[model samples]
Target: MDIDRRTLLGATAMPFVPSVLSAAVSADDWGSIAREYDVTREIIQLEHGNWGMMPRPVLQAYRAMIERVNRDTSYYARRGMAGDLEGVRAQVADAMGVAIEEIVLTRNATEAMKALILQYNRLQSGDAVLYADLDYDSMQASMQALATTRGVRVMKMALPEPATRQNLLDAYRMAFDADPGIRMVLLTHVSHRTGLVLPVAEIATMARQRGIDAIVDAAHSVGQLDFRLPELRADFIGMNLHKWIGAPLGVGALYIRKDRIDAIDPDPAEDPARTDIDARVHTGTPDYAAQLTVPAALAFQAAIGGSRREARLKQLRDRWVRPLRDMPQVQILTPDDPAMYGAITSFRLRGRTSHDENVELARTLLERHGIFTVHRDGLASGSCVRVTPALATQESELDRLVEAIRELAS
Candidate 1:
């Protein structure tokens, strides 16, 4: 006799069972995992792309570390903190399939990417650097500063709104072929504006063949996607642990390939002779508690695995987006292609693409329907409201968002 899948899972849920997760799990099973997150009950949160709320286990670990640091203070600072930091770094490096020598911790993606951008030593006075409009604003500012101080040219492009694989590749190809003076390109692994996942390895290879380097801004992609350093085929990258990794806030990292570490200038705050990746970052008086809790966050993510989490987040995004795609006056920014996106998506009404209009729409969603989203600017096409769902978000919560958009769009 054959039994149902849920029944089979229930039968195996015995004492001392570990949290083994599978992407094919039933809705009830997904909800069971969702319960482990301590999200707010007052609002239907659909803006988790900014920062992820830590799961209960990670939060517990964070609180415990805080207490321990408070108890010992200077002693831990002088002695125990070094060993704990090394252990966390080893776990993070192991998880990403990278060497510990190549990674360094920072406050967040802004700090990490800024360090990578401002410290790159390849540009000449007239050489050009390329970046897209959808790149993070802070990183863009750092690139602009390079142009002013170092006298390098800055070129910007806009991604196609309804982007396709071939078109996306073609755009970058044309850009590189058109300009030999462009020596460095900044790429976003997954766009924060519309959740469009660029083909990083392909673009990076294109840049390399032309003697150009690529710096990846992976703020929203690391824990949300399954690929790692070697897979991206880039020499430098900046990542966020607080966003999708569900670690405590104020944690991020940067990666410089072992062979290419010397190409970037060291942080002046540190000894100039130090060429290690850590020398690129100089976060004074670090958040020792959060740094110590990084291992627990890594452990929690390891239990569920990156592939499973990626599948689950994509599933949730599709569920809400599929029903609303055909609705008139609503334009979905993220394409339906699974390979092109993860959890984050954005939408705009037929003519509501202006900054004020999009902001008002987001306000209406929150005030009228109790669904929360954020208005994002800097899309070359126009502004839109970004909707992001966390791993802990429920189907019902997304359904409410769908219904509210239906009502608003009508």
Candidate 2:
């Protein structure tokens, strides 16, 4: 197989033409690649939004980092740790086209998000925090924690589906206006549930105009989606490197506006002026081996070529979607526009108790066909099956997914 691990890692050119993504002939093409990688083409594993499986080179590099660290733990930590972290931060920031000062390494998206949310030192007892109903549950839970424990008001509103960019901006605009007490907003760059891209920068503009802070949860956005932090225009941003970029776990990032860093009180009494973004939020010692692998993932992406991988994934998503779109029983919850979507999508079968049935259906698909997907509810309050495609996912597997769901629904 020319599609060996080395080949995947060594692909260095980016002939990325998004319009090249057509529904036809794609599944078979992707099928061969999946088989070459020993990834099953018979069943779809459309679940990369939660945890992206690592590329072969990334996996190898992760093991190499561990072995290297095991040889001289403290020596590596003290001798080159500072320089290495700086180098990694610079690499990551460059990947996102941001200044190195804007990037800080963190354990995961949750820590990054929490630290950003807590940074709004102006948040008072009567102040309100607004977030979309389609926001990640963990973020919602964080807001709940803030309301109950921090004496702030929390507003979680439903986001309109099949929504346009303006539709999203309207929701946030209304939410902020309805309550002058609203001091902050937590926006999702891409919803983990429906994979609908949000209007982050526009919302950020609205927030700043009103003297409020906005934090964007880019957990599922970083590698899977093409973007820069400043474009989101949020005061703060948090993302996970493990899922999309294939970094080893214990890896994510916090991006804060340089001006906002001063207002943020570092956890465990660290100074924000240090320029070590890691020092600002991640107070505890992280797994160094895992952190070290981040650069490897970044390099691997560069090698396999970002633009090519991104286009291929987009093509896969389009292929998975086309078969189900016109079916009467199928309700596609993800946006029809590529601009409003990423490497993920969601849909549902028309039925009663959609949530329970969707979960059971997902379980059956996995059990019967080796297909794996996550079923979601609560955000927009309907049962929907979430589909995330990784670089390893192939078209034949998606065909099975389309057919299997159709058969089950019928």
Index of the highest-lDDT prediction: 1
Error of 1 at 170 (Å): 0.7
Candidate 2 lDDT over 333-405, as tens digits, reads 8877777887888888765336788888789889987888988887665778888887787667788888887
The weakest ten consecutive residues by lDDT in model 2 span 15-24
- Candidate 1 wrongly placed segments (more than 4 Å): 1-28
Q: Which stretches of candidate 2 lie over 4 Å from their true place?
A: 1-43, 269-276
The clash tally of candidate 1 reads 0
Residue 199 of model 1 has an lDDT of 91
Best TM-score among the predictions, by candidate number: 1
